[model samples]
Target: MKKRFGLLLALIAALVMLVVPVGNTTHAQAADNSLEKIQKKGVLVMGTSPDYPPYEFQATVNGKSTVVGMDVQIGKKVAKDLGVKLKIKSMSFDSLLVALQTGKIDMIISGMNPTPARRKNVAFTHTYYQGGYDIVINKTDKAKYKNKDSFSGGTLGAQTGTTQYNASKSQTKNTTVKGMTSQSDLILALQSHKLDGVAMEKPSAEAYVSNNKQLAAIPSDFNMSSSATSSAIAFRKGSTSLVNKVNKTVDQIKKENLVKKDYLPAAGKYLKTNTVNTSMTHYWKAFLTGIEYTLIITVCSVFFGFIIGILLALARMAKGNFFKNLLRWIATAYVEFIRGTPMMVQVMFVYFGLGLFVNLPALTSGIIAISLNSGAYVAEYIRGGINSVNIGQTEAARSLGMSNGETMRYVVLPQALKNIWPSLGNEFITLIKDSSIVSIIGVTELIYQSNIVRSDTYRGVAPIVVIMVLYFILTFTASRILNYFERKMQHD
Candidate 1:
């Protein structure tokens, strides 16, 4: 019997080795079979920011589910030209750039500029739309800002990641430039008198001033380095074929004046009519801080939750009718409640609502909320793993005069944990991302950092991109660690 049991254990371990494929960094790159994969998959994923009007915006037209804007139209044309279905993945303005770098999407036609930093990671097609920065001020203050120099010492606003943001930050030596996430947001701030003036691309500014009579573009010599920051399409580095195709298509569209007829008509009402300066360094430090926060929150939540989850799983699996069933129900209810609700609500509940009831510290609230939310799912994963253990092994251990505790501790639990390891790893990956929700509670997690950067710098895209990269690193690292343990256990 002992020999048979040992053979069975060896067989189980071997099976585990075959089942769990270890992680590899190679998956980060686009496959050589990219084109074929798309042809077979029948869909082309494109990244764009839905909040940037005339570029991308949420709209329900004639009862149709659609996100309409300039970039959306451009995306449609590009996809149609490629003879593939287009699927838009709406994300923050900054994440779209990383999506291109990671090859998660084929291209970005979201009115992106060809910056030196961005060019290092992704290639750009010909300038599809002419872009430049424009300075905007409250109607009441427009008379004072005749030129860039006049606005010295005044507070200015610019959307993060835009050339306008860089220009305003660099050129306005005396002025404090507030960076935000979107042009619309900047305009709103200007109108609300929260900002003295705003520097934005001409097309985007024109779009705003045309709609709101309370704002006007400052008539200045328009001190900016570039004449027009030619907006272009972006693709992953080394994707020569895709880049070439987009370049050729954009040229054809431009030559045919289809950009005016199709893209402009669909989105022109949304961009600024004037041009503004472009620059590179637009609040990089602030953006980096946001990414740091996101990483910290993800790590803390997953670590704490893992410990609590194991304990809860053990309790749920206990044989007693009361504690076991009660724990099982509790775990089920917790998971269902969290999974059923929006993460945003839960974040607010913990951060704002619960705090009012009890004066708990912010860090404590953040950790508790994230752990509670994550622990529920972890419990289910642990339970599944425990249940996977063969019943015969437990019975045999008991028949051998082993106590129930000894059988569970020495014979059953180890095997069960190994089986459920993958699920637990997957849960951690999810937790790493879901932790972003805690940022709403002002936990200074990655997303919150982005918000702060936007609040201070008026630059939205760069801070958001930083946050996305931070999240990617966290998830990627978690995935690798999980795979490492899974592989080690299997091989052993």
Candidate 2:
């Protein structure tokens, strides 16, 4: 027995040695063809967060909402130099890096800073623009607070993952630094007196103060290194060829001072048009597009989620042989893992992790992620519903010379679905709201579109109110439709 055990261990070790690569894994590294790939595709995709004005923000051109700012101008120049068309992909600021690393976008030109921590993960071109920080405050409190130090004992806000946010946290004494995902949200917090001031780039602060009379700007006065204050374009690491090509554009822009001469002025013109009509009515088309995408995501997720739930429910209930038990274990584990993680993390994982191999479109990735999440929850409801069915009915079907599959199909599932109709309807309604989670990946759902409207109009609250009402109407209408079906199910 000892010799047999020794032999078994040796066999396992030998198998492991054969399966794993030993050394010198350079052959595994991907080739540096980033620039060639972009040119072949004929489109240089630039990722950005469009909420930051003067750097990247939403604007309406030719009656259509569009992304425009200094970063976009730089992206266009880089693409032109490469002899390719430019495409802008907008996501949250924090998601930009993940999106680039996952090959969802070719480059990032969203006024991104080349901090040391970021440089370790991605390659950066030469600095395209040198920028500084400013603190936005309520006009009434402008005199009360002179700089970062004056915010002592009060909360100062900044966009999460930004240099200003880090500076606010490190440089201030006896101050609470609050971070939010959106600059518009931070500004809203300031107006509502939730924050003493909001820290942001100087250009963005100027744009906000010029647009809103209630706001004023002051110097941040936080010590920073040049890398913390300089903006550059980011690419996936090891893209030396792409980085070198884009650096030429960056160098020419700096030599000619094109940012100050042309780009900033062009971005300023867009900011001017943004405030001309702050009313939600003028952006009706934007809201309509939002509703359309929202419905598309919710409907697709529900349909796929329900199908997946049914399969998982049946799999979890399986009991017979070794293979059947394995299926049950897998189904159970999947449901638990999905329920344990946040939907946002799951969405990002699906978009970035699964994205390593397949180049899924943002909308497609959103639906797939949301559907997988909803399925895990829906499985529980289905399992409970299936268990709630009387055992005697299943026994009766079995005794009628029917197989287990047939019994489940003819007797158990129909009754189970009927019993869980209301729960299923509730899940459907919940998904309508939860579908907004995909907005982080730039799906252009209602929340994303509303963010654009807020950035474009610079009236943060109005866009929120519009989306709130629109969501209520969507969920309310869905609830009524579900009720009608539930009534029909009961009557039958």
Candidate 3:
């Protein structure tokens, strides 16, 4: 019901934006001057979720937020050639298209393959790179199923939305095909013995199998299609001009043989294959998508949690006999339960446990799970802030004939929140970092994105390290914002 209400509110807001004259004028302005506005602003807002390697990943070069990968390098080149600064907005692959459609971004450069269903929404550039499916398995299991045709009754896993899944579904009649959201999940399942094997892109599978002693991909002799299932940049439908420019840029890059020479260096360590490494570009999209979800979970959890905490704090601080006591008890129980339990358990209860009793949308389940978990910590922060207010301030307000509400609003809260500003900032940072835990509930966050990268590239360490830096940048920004507000309040 909460989800439905939120959706309804969003729909109503969208409708209002559509019907209002102001919205009409804004839309008209967007249509007329979008390109001009971008040129004038000197920024090309490129949207991509960078969790995949050889395509995108985070790495520290000279201690900056260096988003590396083939796509990252290419995007930087595109922006540089256009004489515009690149403002890369990280989001899930699905959300990248939405950003383009909403005119929030000029173009998308994620590892998005052109599909019939997607073509209706976005225009695509020329095909850039191509590869196809391969089956991966642990070395111990390889002896049992030496060939693809032999895995008739095996438990198989594949990323939820990929061509490899279609192939896996058709190839094995008695196979239990587990549709995981990202390549990382499949890899984890396979490693943990939850799956006998996984069907994935040949490059990514090869890369993964090469890195681990227990894992290995099917032999290279196994014929996989090398058709134009290549990835391409996407723009809103009818944006032929932008598509053409991107295509030209891609041609220039490939003509330069950037893939063989600088693909790894420019894209971070994940793109560069060592003597022992194998090709694993296929897992890039899944990893990037996961990172995007992590960011979403962080933002949503913090935003909603702030409101809930504020309300709860105010309730607990209220002057009443029965009501205050009741709120105090409820708040205390909530804090203790949440702070005492493991976040992993909380996630499982919401996704799998509650799912057994009631149906829930995947995204809704993730949001509710994280929000509820984060709320407990937020409530404690609020309570601490409320309690930190000097008792003399309340007494002074009361002597001044101020109401209890006025005392809180003017005399107590403002001062209390100021003292707790650093703690609030710390909580927000913790929430952002901890949000990665939601992936267990299938909330595709940063770590989940890293899992996707590792699954696709089979090069561990590099992609994860890159993601850690990205996360640091994210948390740092939150801290800066908190500090800004703190300073402003201090001055006020």
Candidate 4:
């Protein structure tokens, strides 16, 4: 029985190794395979940051909140030209390059610039649109920031990992540049007076000014470096065939002036007015759908976390140094590694980083990332609870002829669970909140929905306020339910 049980545990641990990126650097991409995979999959995944309006943003289509904009339509056309279905993954601007490198997406159409530094890492298609960088400021502050010199010693905002960020730091002397995650966030910072000005493409800056009277873009001397002016699609390095095909499409779009003549007008028509309640009412379905995904991810992640926590605790408590040490190292390394790293990094690594190794869906990848993260903290709670139980209880079980496994199963865990219930409850609540980070991978959770609502609505704070309330309600109800269970356990 002991030998059989040991064999079973070893097999389970080996299986766990398959999903944990134990030392993976992304799946290897070779010549021909990159394009071949897409043809075989029959779907081309295009990544973009939906927060960049006019280029890519959200709008209502047939009574549903759909992602639509210049790049989205162009992505559709490119996918059609390649004779494949199109799938859009909306993510943070910074993660787009790494996502392509890891094979999480086939291409990126997020108004990216093909700067020389980027060219070394990834290939870019022909320029799809032409524009220049400009500064946006509150109308009242226009005179204060007319030229590059005007921003001297003032704080400015730019999207992180973009050419604008570098320009903000180098173009003007002594200006404190704050790097934000999205264009929406940078705009909010500018409005809230956290930033005196923001650097962006002329069109993006103009789009914001058109929607909000208080905001205005400087007339386009477009002071950015030449490399930042033209926008293009991105692909993994050496993806020759895919890049060639996409460049052909970009050439056609430019020849026909599709962006100015067709895409811009179509995007304009889909724009939603910026009314707080009206936006909420129109986008209620999207919010509800987001809530549903959030709940599902939370429940599933907690369930798996508990399983891993209990197993790690048992491995730590077990005897037999050789086999035990192996399990202990695995468990301890996982706990410390996950707990030490940021959840955002873990989720991206799982979605795209792990995509190099496996083909998990967005929802499944999110659950796995959160579960591993939760397990680390959960293990400590479990280990502490088990240690707190009187040692005499285990001796008594042994005297009654219980095997070590049986004693742990029938005696130790039940008491430990009682002590750890509150800790477990706290972990669950935190998971509900931490799950928001997975939105960076385009999971469509509450935070992602809030972004979409704000994208087209043009009113930012109100939609997020609604999501804040929903998150509060979710955590509050979960706390009450957990308290009920904890009380019942105590009474029994």
Candidate 5:
């Protein structure tokens, strides 16, 4: 027991040593050449959550859907000043900071606040937009609720991981605070009367109320410091050179009052156009793009995941030597670790954690993460299938002068796969649905496109129902194909 414990401690210490240096190296690199690198690349990538209207949201320009709003305008200005072309990457609001820190983006301008807590992890520029908070309630309850204080016994909703969310939980009395990932979801809840109010930035609240006549906004009345209400661009930690350069543009915007006179009015026009056609059919292109990406991710992940599963399943079943035992132990540990954690965290880790070493596009990262996750589960199924094979089959192959590898390759594996075909088919179908988790990192899959539709049209349920039917169509078609293959195999 003592020897085993010591060995475990040594393994843990080795992992820690491996992890610590990567962080230090990333920080050291970020401390310098931040501006030179962007100029050399000739493109400044700005990451933002495009679900927040008038701050940053999707809009149609020249009949092409794209990310727009005041924050995007600010990003364009910063990129122009740096003499680099601007590339906007739309993701969830909660992922912007991680994407910046991991170098997935050069900077973040997603209506994000520069609170002291966030400052510890990433560098922030001077404030570009100073905004306040508001609580949006159903217009019918506009008279009953005056402010945040009015929701004493009712539930309030806010986007998870925002300043307003934290404040709603900490500052309110006897009020139940509900957190959702998107502002559209919160507003949908309010419209359904599930929530008494939804707290958000003043501009967003106003936009929602104006677009949806059933909603009205009131002051949140929560005490806040300037840092909590102010928006700034964030870069990787120690990117002082880049932050200082971008501060010049932020200062110019504030001095010229461009946010009020220019950006807001421009974004409002898009909002008007967006509301003009809220019908689902108007956004078929968006959903089609979504289906294309979703299919790509699922198919790629399934093919690679099957290959990985075979290797891992073989490694887990290895025996007869010290090296084989070690391989088996490592494979078992990997399978357990993956199965224990959530797929969402794995997606983020692959995109952001591996990003420190090499830059990967969001689609590539999603495929890699989902493939790895699916491989672990598939390995277990393969292992069970192997176990179900009769020992006499292996003996029969060996007696016929077959080597161990030949036995597995020509005899055992083929039969084992036939036995496990149904399970593998189920895994493939499950992956079709599970692929939606990748949208958190902005892969532009079905769920992500649906979110853009929700934000664009301001009609939540229609987009959701459309995606629901689309997903069912995908899964149902996949199931029929799998069944046809199964029948063919059984006949053979």
Candidate 6:
């Protein structure tokens, strides 16, 4: 009923758009009717963050890449019992609650802990699995971090918005907690020497340690806060019927000891798989789709950046010292800031941090970050393009009785564009490749797609090699097209 009503409301809104102003939009009410909605749609839309192994991580099974884990199995059981097909949507774990609340997903099957604050926003099924947290550290520092007190004034990591993050705060003294969106990212950070230790589930820490030889779980048990930090499936607040349906499935899983029987096997399979063979060729869709999204983000963001670049270029060339100086300062400051910061930081800020001020779709936020970041650099290229135009051309236009604006509009600007076409084209190519940064926020572009493949297939170097080849094809093809355009311009 929730989704049926939502669909009906969407149709009504579409029709209303023809008559009503865009300012006043019809809002769909989200309620406890999710059970009815899934029944009607015949598909249970489950949201998860795919970076966590053994609990809804991505894996290619029988030549098809998809999310697979103990949590996923539980979700599947629920959907099957409900007589519906299961549809999995991957996103950041922190975004799952909002995704459920907004009806973007019918339920969240990620390994989400039912904290009191989270419970207020969404209903949780009964504890599906209970796992205590453990601290993972470099083997060299294992002796250094034997107890909680040893971590005082040391850097620790956890998944942002998770119980582990909160636990890291209360359980350890004077520890600086670094929170990331995904367990994979946290593990990577730990490997890079940026974090002294990370507080996460024992299973995941164990998995990392088993896979990465340099890492070790602390021998002495440092509490990850509470045994009460039990994992549960999440649904929108007031989704009582849905909650009950999920709980029923969880009861079955617990009765079966599915954690040991199912989750361990899955994690073992992921840990063991290392490369693609003739048998795995059917999973090509994951790679193909990844390339598709990368191209789309690259193309769209570059076009958006081009528009921004033009405006900034005009501002740089504006009349009067005050106006010119102000615009120049603003444009210069924007360019420098964007150039100075890592694209990953910009992506995280726009996708995660910017949400406090406004609501935006994940993809939209990513594109906006890419566009804004690209715009700054593109503006400098455009300014250089304009500057390359001979001063004699501007003077000649002025001598012909044309105004300063008219001279730039007719002669100077057009010639400037001709000179800068290749440079601008190069910018577009760069933006395409750099757009992969947005995947950190779960945009699912090429790199993110490959990540899913890696997650699912447990093939690390193979996926990286494949990604490199795919990116080269994209960038190389793009450079060729740009060269063609540049040559065509010369002939014209």
**Compared with the true structure, what per-residue lDDT tens digits does model 3 show for residues 93-154?**
33455446555578877666776666766677776666555678988887786655667777
> lDDT by residue for model 4 over 360-397, one digit each (tens)?
88899999999988988889999999999999999999
- Winner on lDDT between 3 and 5 is 5
Q: Which pairs of residues collide in model 3?
A: 58-466, 68-267, 69-267, 203-279, 203-280, 204-280, 283-456, 294-445
Better of 1 and 6 by TM-score: 6
| Cα lDDT listed for each candidate | 0.64, 0.86, 0.64, 0.80, 0.87, 0.73
Count the clashes in each prediction.
Answer: 30, 0, 8, 1, 0, 4
Our tally of clashes for model 3 stands at 8
Q: Assess candidate 1 and give its TM-score to the true structure.
A: 0.54
lDDT for 40 in candidate 6 is 93
Candidate 1 per-residue lDDT, tens place, 1-492, comes to 000012222333344334323342244243444445666777888876555545665443432324567777777877887789998765545445533443446777666777665676577788777755667787787567886778787888876766666677677678887877655567667766788887766655666566566778864345554323667777766666666676777888789887668776666532322112111134455446655765666678778887777777777665667768887777667677886866655554554344433655445666778887777778778778778888999999999999988998898878987998888788778876776665433355565545544433333355556667767877788789889999999998
Taking all chains together, each candidate's TM-score versus the true structure is 0.54, 0.93, 0.55, 0.90, 0.94, 0.70
lDDT of candidate 1 at residue 313, scale 0 to 100? 77
Regions more than 4 Å wrong, model 2: 1-31
User: Residue-wise lDDT of candidate 2 within 1-492, one digit each (tens)?
Assistant: 000012222333343335335342233245567778878999989998898989999999999999999989999999999999999999887777767766789999887888877887689999988888889999999789899999999999988777788788889989999888898888888998999999998999999999999999999898988888889889987888989999999999999999999999999999999989888999999889999999999999999999999999989989999999999999999999999978887787777767766778889989999999989988999899889999999989988999988988889888898989889989888988998899988998899989999899888788999999999999999999989988898899
> Which residue runs does candidate 3 get wrong by more than 4 Å?
1-35, 59-65, 146-148, 219-228, 254-434, 437-492
Off by over 4 Å in 1: 1-34, 219-228, 268-492
Arranged by lDDT with the best first, the candidates are 5, 2, 4, 6, 3, 1
Show pairs that collide, candidate 4: 27-356
Query: What is the C-alpha lDDT profile of model 6 across 145-261, one tens digit per residue?
Result: 885567888898887766667667777778898876667667667877889988777777777677666889874254543424477877866667777877887898889898788
Question: Better model by lDDT, 4 or 5?
Answer: 5
Candidate 3: RMSD over Cα atoms? Answer: 11.8
The best candidate in terms of lDDT: 5
10 residues in a row with least lDDT, candidate 5 = 1-10
Cα deviation in Å at residue 24, candidate 2? 12
